[model samples]
Target: MSKSEDIVINWARRLQSLAQAGLTYSKEKFELERYQEIRDIAADMMAYKSDLPLAKVKDLFCNETGYQTPKIDTRAAVFQADKILLVQESDGRWALPGGWCEAELTVMENCIKEAKEEAGIDVTVEKVIALQDLQKHSSKIFPYGVLKVFFLCHKTGGHFQANSETIATDYFSLDNLPPLSVNKTCVEQIKLCFEAQADKNWQTRFE
Candidate 1:
């Protein structure tokens, strides 16, 4: 990552850590409110420093009452017989099976759950394919902040089942994946997943 990207990520991470700590230790509602105020202040400071608009900064800081940690986005690339599983997104575009990671679950567990929830398929997570920092990529969909983790998964059970988040699921050869939801997943990244699976090496990439 470049120096600017590193700086932004570090500041964002620190803000999240502070929010998590506050949520964990504060006993009184007033104290928790104070911590949230602090978190907002920190996020505002980052926005000012990074030149992000004020509204965007506020959105980044907003979270559930007791859940203040930075959110993780998890995705799984399920490959079978030289074809990769892809889901048709709500926006009428095709992408991988994944979504925002819940705080209650591990990264791998979240990956599996997303596959089932979005594509209606059971999958066994094999290894991490790559990790990408969204801020560095200038994404409008995630204008606030996000960190995405992509995992290489293998089909374990069940057939394709589309959920509310997706319209349909299908497998495509590497040469034929439709236009992806870049904010969620990218074709080049999917290619990396394929390479990692073929090499049997759990490689990780960062932006």
Candidate 2:
């Protein structure tokens, strides 16, 4: 996106966050109405800029009622020798086996669950590889902020089976990576995981 578009999106996100907080904590009826208006305005701004309709944008961006916080996503980086496991998404591109963290599960548990669900692999957590701010690394724009957690996992068992989210699974080296699902997994993030895997003393990277 262009600089102007980025500015608008950033402002919309901030406005929606403020409005959400207001709606959650404010007791005055007039103040609640004002917050609701602010949220509608945020949705309008996004709708004007994007192809989505006003109602769609509102549902996607303004329906949450809480103090706004970044959504958490978990990624499992399972390696076999020099190759890393990657699942072919239904979109016909590859990504690390992972998804949105469940509210009831710990991050590590989410990692294990995602691996089993997406790639049909059983894995045990080895160490955290990185914690990434999605906005910093991804080009795709989200209605809310996102925090992506990467875990270096050791495969215990299970083999790939066709699933709803993924069509196939395979291992690839850095020298030969397939077209990646950039929104979910990027080259730099994969490189960080490889670096963590090679060094036993690797510290968990953040930001």
The residue ranges of model 1 lying beyond 4 angstroms of the native Cα positions read 1-60, 64-69, 141-144
What tens digits encode model 1's per-residue C-alpha lDDT throughout 46-149?
Answer: 66566568677666555445544346889898888888888998788888889888879999999999888988888898787777776555434232457789
Residue 45 accuracy (lDDT) in model 2:
87
TM-score of each: 0.70, 0.96
lDDT (0 to 1) per candidate: 0.75, 0.93
The alpha-carbon deviation from the true structure for residue 141 of candidate 2, after best TM-score superposition, in angstroms, is 1.5
Q: Give the C-alpha lDDT of model 1.
A: 0.75
Task: Give a tens-digit lDDT track for model 2, residues 54-161.
Answer: 888878898788899999999999999999999998789999999999999999999999999999989999999999999899777677789999999999999889
Give stretches of model 2 more than 4 Å off: none
Clashing residue pairs, candidate 2?
Answer: none
